[model samples]
Target: MTLSALDQLKNLTTVVADSSDLEAIRQFRPLDATTNPSLITAAAAQPENKALIEAAFEQARAENYENGELIERAIDILTVKFGVEILKLIEGRVSTEVDASLSYDTAATVAKAKELLHLYQSYGIAKERVLIKIASTWEGIQAARLLEIEGIHCNLTLLFGLHQAQACADAKVTLISPFVGRILDWYKKAENVSSYPIDKDPGVQSVKQIYNYYKQQGIHTQVMGASFRSIDQVLGLAGCDLLTIAPALLEQLEQDQREVTAALSVTAAQQASVIERPVQDEQSFKAEVEHDLMAAQLLQSGIDGFIKAREQLHALLRQSFGLDEEIKA
Candidate 1:
């Protein structure tokens, strides 16, 4: 009997469930979990989660919040509520994102991350058990750096380029989640090509590029490939520090018993040519992003998408409390 592809991955990588679906995480039994407003919105629509939704709203009202404040507090509590459930089922930390609208506000991002930490603590969960996820914008990276100094770990997400990855390494943050599928999606749409050769797949190459660069530089900011669209993409980066995968793909791996091989080698990365660039700061980071069309577009779009999703979640919460009409008026 050959080992399943996922089994092979688990041997070399720390598998994380990239979803807010508790059942998916429980069934897959991944070591860690990650959630974002987009994922949470998807989960919020499910009938099974109605009780949790109501509970979050009730908690906010009990705190004497009114109108907009009630909605905002419920959003925070709802995120933490999901985190609490996820933490109960997994021993590893859960990555809960700060509001994406704050992506470019250093102080605001930092404050939001702190509020999330405080909320987790209020739930009796230690700060160490949570990774406050922030975007990898220039401001986001700097915010993570500040949080790191205060002993808070961060996962810099929505990453689309090596420049940001390099900056993240310089920041000495806990991890970087480079988006694999999104990059490929961009290239495919731009190039009008249906497919590329397996090994030449752009998304797979992106993660490998970041991973190799990290290893060659001896940077400890772990490279975790995220937003994968296919199993081949997952197998292509089998030896990443971590891979946060959707449960649908996890199910595909679970049902298949094919052999999986180690696709990345840190030793190889160390032996690979080093990519040299100046250390990044706010100004240089902005300039570099402007120069790279893909990174700039993706960063803005990612933030916009998350912000929209967060708003949707809030609207859902308001509707749940029968305040949607009142708020509209």
Candidate 2:
């Protein structure tokens, strides 16, 4: 029998399970995995993941032997636990995000990223087995650029514009995740419309433009489409470097036996879009992104959401340690 859409995608794209639920990852067998603070908070609340959470605290107790220290330690412990689990199944890297509270602080973002990598290394995880997830702000990109030179790969998240991709490419980061569903969400809300063309969906268009630009410039930074609102959005960009899809949508793809074909190609990119000019510098890039309302709001909102989720996770850890969770609140 011919391959299903999911199988065909497996051939073209590095399927990434975008969830903190390790069980869901086992079900899909994605080649990679990604998790944000929000997903980690959600997963930690579940009954199944409670053991993992408790184990984190236990491991922390073994090290620092204090409630506050346990809480701090659990953050690294739980995160690496997820990465370790996923690494067992996937051949590629697993992305664990930095503390969202540090997104605006380039130095802090770089510090926390190194801490995460150190924890992974302590657990026998190779440096190549991880991609430090960072927000695509100017600070985040700068942090990633520094780490990339140290042999630490990065996955730049919350990317919503061509400028973000260009910056990341210039930084020579390992990968960039363009959020497809989130972009669609923004355009729909702005236009007061219910639907739009799959191919022309603002999110899809954003990734396509970034993808073409990268290929045209011969930038090796991978483009991974994320945050899909529907399978149609996922199907719309079938040949991206990677697509960190949710488990529910992965199931939908597995069940839908539709014919899948390449919607992007190097040949077409070379012929159609020419990078006749040099990449934008920081000043112009920042100015250009500031002019785009949707990108600005989405980028800020995405960062805010991560910060809130990180606060929630910290609250959970505090409560788990019999500390004052309200302080975290």
Candidate 3:
């Protein structure tokens, strides 16, 4: 009896579902789950989740929040609402991202993360079961550094380069989501090529570099490869600490009965020659990110994209609550 590729991959890595759709999460049964603004927006727009959205709005309204504050509170509640449901199905942690608008503001980011944790606790969820996801800006990393001391776990996201990953490790972040497909997308457009061989894929190489470096440096921060475009990319990083794959790809892996191999190992990383870089200060961190065009562009665009998604969610909430209708009247 041959095992499915997903089952074999699970033996080598912790598989996490990257979606807010409860049915999909239930079906795939990923060990953990993650949600971002885009994912939440899409989930909130679905008719099946209408009650979740309305319930969050009512809760926010019951608290006497009005207008912008009401919508803002609802969005936070809605994000955690999805997370709480996701946690019920998965045994591991559920990553609930902070508002991307705070990506550049460390103080705001820290405050929002704490607020989200408090909301989770309101639903009887343990702090240990939640990872506050934040963008990987210099300020965001500093914010995670502060949160980690307070025992709030964080997942630094939108990471595209070594400097961002190094800074995250320095901060002792609980995890870092280095994007796989997004990196590949950037290179394909920049280099004017359609695709690279799976072995030579820039995205796969980026994750391999980060994973090996962390293993070599004895860093305890977990690496979760995210945003995969194909199952081949997922297979390429078989022994990653974790991989947050989309539901479509997860379904594909569940159906395929191919043999999977561990492409990374601690033993191999320990033997590899990796350079050690000093922890970055704010100035150096900014300079290094600026020096790398891909990282700089993608980091900003990812933030903007998330911010847009957040706004879209907010709009959906306002319409659902009839706030838009009241204003028109």
After aligning candidate 1 to the native by TM-score, how far in Å is the CA of 53 from where it should be?
1.2
Model 1, residue pairs in steric clash: none
Residue lDDT tens for model 2, 1-329: 97778998888777899998888988888888999989989988888777888888888887865655557668778988878878988787899999877887899988989989988998899999899999999989999999999999999999998888889998999999999988898899999999998867989988988888888889899999999999888888888888999999999999888888877777777777575545577788788779989889999999999889877888888876678754532
Candidate 3 lDDT by residue in tens digits, 146-236: 9999999999999998899999999999999999999999999999999999899999999999999999999999999999999999999
lDDT for position 189 in model 3:
99
Best by TM-score: 3
Which sequence of candidate numbers ranks them by TM-score, best first? Answer: 3, 1, 2
Better of 1 and 3 by TM-score: 3
Looking at model 1, which ten-residue stretch has the lowest summed lDDT?
320-329
Query: Candidate 2, overall lDDT?
Result: 0.87
Clashes of 3: 0
- For model 2, the stretches where C-alpha displacement exceeds 4 angstroms are 65-70, 275-279
lDDT of 3: 0.94
TM-score of each: 0.97, 0.95, 0.98
The TM-score of predicted model 2 comes to 0.95
- lDDT to native, each model: 0.90, 0.87, 0.94
Pairs of residues at least 3 apart in sequence or in different chains that clash in candidate 2? none
